[model samples]
Target: MRYRRFGKTEMLLSVFSLGAMRYLESAANAEKTIWHALEVGINHIETAQGYGKSEEFIGQAMRNGLSKQRDRFYLTTKIGPTKDADSMRRQIEQSLKKMNVDYVDNFDIHGINLYEHLDLVKDPNGCMKAVREAIDQKMLGHVGFSTHGSLEVILDTIRTGLFESVNLHYYYFNQRNAPAVQLAHEKDMGVFIISPSDKGGMLYNPSEELSGVCYPYTALYMCDRFLLSDPRVHTLSLGAANPSEVDSHQDAWDNDAPMSELEAAVLDCMNRRYTLLENDRCSQCYQCLPCPEGINIPEVLRLRNLAIGFDMVEFGKYRYKMFENAGHWFPGNKAIRCTDCGDCLPRCPENLEIPRLLRDTHDRLHGEEGRRLWE
Candidate 1:
């Protein structure tokens, strides 16, 4: 497996890291997957307190024997928006309890999306102070933040130069955060790409149109290669469902076979197809947020494109359910609760017709009975 310097740290992590989001439902399954990952040389395992049961499962799995391999891996977790410094400290203590670890290799402030959040962290009594105190106490080896926001927030966070690492959404399908990744590299901070495959549901079977455009390379391998091809990406965290998923990725890593001329041609064709798909129209800036309804606008658009491009009916159905079920989690304004305000159009980075796309998603998925299983 190819290894890269994990930011300014001396540790060299595998190009592919294991993400524990999908392991919330089953401990046995999670353990098997984690074991398989370790067996395959994936030394970086990422989890978050926001993801239910993931930390606890990792702790249990390690206690069952995986702990012996602890030194072989790099462990990371995150702290969410704590109400106050006392609460933040308590949460960190709880996280340690759940993970059964005295200290984590890396700890980050979860979801630093808005500019104001920076102020909150830098506040004397805010979570950032708590994080610093934790590090001073040797409770954390390194400190960082994760974001799903605009370039402005990303650049601002990087400029602080306070973090040893930064985790952000980045993938071949969504190069919106590429600049952030580059900035992280320039600042000598570890750059972690979260859920690259699952972003916009890119790794699933491609739509017919997308398949027609990206034929021989198979959407999965193409997506993996696209991310791995970039040297700036220190690691691509994959939410593998089973041992087989790990094995499939292992194939990509182990293969000594060079990209054939045909493969290169296919990739070029896919890139061109993506270019035409967006038409340079939507920058995916996501400024018109807080949809009155819980719609995850960017995510919906991405899944819709995946549905149309790949022609995967089941995948489309799944995406629809995710939106409908998780609808309540987002602020009412940021979701399907949107009013017919054309106000968001001007603020958009890509200048997309936001209302129109929102309407399209509702009409297409809401009518399908199979898609409403979440309801």
Candidate 2:
């Protein structure tokens, strides 16, 4: 496995870190997975209070001989984005007792996805105060946060300089967080990217077309290489529910692979797929923005591309639903809000019938209808 300097906290984190979000049936299963990961060189494990039973399962594994390997790993668990110190303290204590650890190397402010959540942690009387108190007591080593917030909010939180690391999402389809990852590097903060396989376009079960496009390398391996190729990305959270599945992740650990050639192949196929000029696709250029009705036209068109070109109906619906009332996070209006406005038409280089395409974008991915491939 390849390791990278995990910024201010100064640990050499593995490029592929194990995440405990997908703990399987039994404690023994979790124990086996943990042991297998350690044997394979993945030394960082991240878990959270919100992930049901994941903490308890890890504790169970530690109790069953796995504790002997404790020093071989760097442990991190998250707690409250709570409004007060007491709640944070209570959660921290529970995490420690549950994990049966003397101290966690990193304690996270779980999910600070908005300005108010950041406020809860930074309020002096809030979560961070308790976290600092714990650090002083030697029960915690470093403090950080994980977020699913907007780009502006993420950058604002990183700029606070209070964190040793920051965990967020950044992958192929979701390059929206690229700027924040770069900012974290500048701030000397560790960048741990969460759910790269599942959220990075559900790559484990790539479609035939996708498989062909990424020939000589599987889709998941392509994604793993893409994320690891960037210096800003310290590690990717690969969550496995079964011990046998861990081998798939192990296969993705080659740092010396010929990734540039593979990337060119994937991009060559991607460009062809996305450049369609029928009722099926849009160029995804943001030049037609500032829709008079306040709609995210380019974004809608991009999602529209999935349903028509890639036949990724479930993912299209899943993401399309994120726009329902997402406000400025997605910004502008839904496709249904367009009023046949010709304003965007003049700006569009593709000469797409703006209103018609907007309606098509909405109609195709519009309902709660879909067959989810897998989680």
Candidate 3:
């Protein structure tokens, strides 16, 4: 496993940190996965209060001989934003007790997905105050946050200078957060890429076209290498469900050689796929934004791009339904909201039939509504 200096925290964290969210529905599997991760050199384990039963399962593992390896790993947990310091303080204590740990290496204010959430944490008597008190009491090491907010909101949060790290979405399929990652790096804040596999266009079950494009390297390995190639990125969270699942996260190469010739070829192929005019791709330019109806045109079209260009209909439906259901964590109405306003039509460099494509996207990808995993 390769390790990186996790920004200003000064901890050398494995590039493949274990995410304790999925496949942790039971204590036994949780213990098995945790042990396997530690044996395989993953030194960081991150969980959150909203990730049902995860903390309890971790505590159970610790009590079942895993505690003997305490010093061998770093523990991190998160609490949702609360309006008051007392509530935040209670959640912190609960997390510590549930995890069977005296101190968490990192404690994040989870899901600062809206401007109001940022305000809540920054309030003098709100969550950050309690987090600071925890640090002073020696129960928390570094403060951070996870987000699914807009680029504007993310940039605002990073400028606060209150966090030592950030966990957010950034991967090969979606580069919207690239600027935020760069900003975090500039501020010397640890950049933890959240859900790189699943939220990253469900690469675990990649479409045959995408898999072929990443040939010689599987989509999962290619995505991992793509993110790790950036010196600014500290780690990619792997939500492994079982011991066997951990093996897939192993690096394709042992050294820090960014973008080897083979990897570059794959990237070139992916770029060609993304830009194929025959696919009616959206190009992901921001010109179609500020929708009067609050629709996120680029995101909707990006999902459409995946569906049409790479046979990723399942991934499209999965994300499309997240519209309106996930709050600011995934703020946007479905493409069905497009009123055929000619505003975005003239601006699109691709001259994509904005309203028509949006309606088509909705028709193709709309399905059973998706609830945010933590919700």
Candidate 4:
């Protein structure tokens, strides 16, 4: 695989890093799968304590002679934004023991996904302090964070200069995080793109229309190359569930010279198709903010686009329910809490009927039936 200088960390991060978030094989097979990645020169491994069995699987694979040369590659496992220093400290120890590593090359403050979550992480006596202590003791070489949060919050976390790298979402479908990627570059922080296929509009199960739009290339390959083509994006996570799935994303490596032609053709088709449903739908512009009841208008509207524009009702419904648990990170009351105040009407450049769309969203995507789908 090709490599990029991962900002401040100075690691030659592989363009296609193995994301160990999905593994469905037996221990022996899991070892073989991880071994194959190493055999193919995948040197960066990203996993999390929360990803069930992932860290343990990697540990077991290493113990079974997957590789004895730990010094050659970078390993990162996430731990906190824990509620307290002690809990976060114990988590670090637990992660080390479970992975059977004396030290990690890098560490992550897992899931600082909102403003308040950032506050919790930076708490003087909380996770931030605990990790610094771990670093001082050489338990980990450096510290960073991962987020499924807004660009604003992600930038806030990067600005602190406490982290050496960052993991955030940025892809073809969601360029909203572009500014965060830029700011991280400015700060010289490593930027790792998370879940390009799964969170990037579920490219694995592309719609028939999407398949046609990204013709000659699977929508997945199109999306991977789209992000890889950009100089600012350091690496894209290839979260392969099975070993065989690895080869597809790797083709994007060093094949960027053809990306300009491919992106123009594919994007024109996709933009034209998606534009058909844009008349009254929200542009996810985030202009209509500070709604008195604290509604996340842009996100709700984006979900609406999935259902209306792409006929992806099932996926739309699944993500809409996430707001119920995501708290202030996703923030705002559901569409039902709009209260018809029209406070957001003037702020919207589209001058669309803000409350009316929220009502439509509430009626269509949110309800007891949809809640059960995710619950």
TM-score per prediction, in order, is: 0.82, 0.85, 0.96, 0.89
What TM value does model 4 have? 0.89
Inter-residue clash pairs, candidate 3: none
Compare the candidates by TM-score and give the number of the best one: 3
* Model 3 residue 64 CA deviation in Å: 1.2
Model 4 misplaced regions, further than 4 Å: 24-26, 292-294, 326-339, 362-375
Highest lDDT scorer: 3
Model 3 Cα lDDT, one tens digit per residue, 1-375: 788999999988988888999865689999999998998889999999989899999999888887888889888898989999999999899988998888998888899998999999779888889999999999999999999888888999999999999999998889988899999999999999999889997988998888888898888888888888899999889898888888877764254568898888988887777665474788888888888999999999999888877778999999999999987778899999888777888788988888988999999998998997756
**1 versus 3: better TM-score goes to:** 3
The sequence of per-residue lDDT tens digits that candidate 2 reaches over residues 1-375 is 888888898988888788988875677788888888888888999998877778888888888777898889999998858878898888899998998888999888877787888788778888888889999999999888998776778999998888989999888766778889999999889999888887576677777766777777787887787788778788889788877777786666867244586576776776576555464456656788777787878778877775665565666666676674544333445689898858998898878887898898888878763321212
Candidate 2: lDDT over CA atoms?
A: 0.79
In angstroms, the error of model 4 at 40 is 3.0
Q: By summed lDDT, which 10 consecutive residues of candidate 4 come out lowest?
A: 366-375
Query: What's model 2's lDDT at 138?
Result: 95
Give the total clashing residue pairs for model 1.
Answer: 23
- Indicate the TM-score of model 3: 0.96
Q: What lDDT is reached at residue 283 by model 4?
A: 75
C-alpha lDDT score of every prediction, in listed order? 0.72, 0.79, 0.88, 0.79
**Each candidate: RMSD:** 4.2, 3.9, 1.6, 2.9
In candidate 3, which residue ranges exceed 4 Å CA deviation?
A: 253-255, 346-349
Residue pairs clashing in model 4 are: 294-332
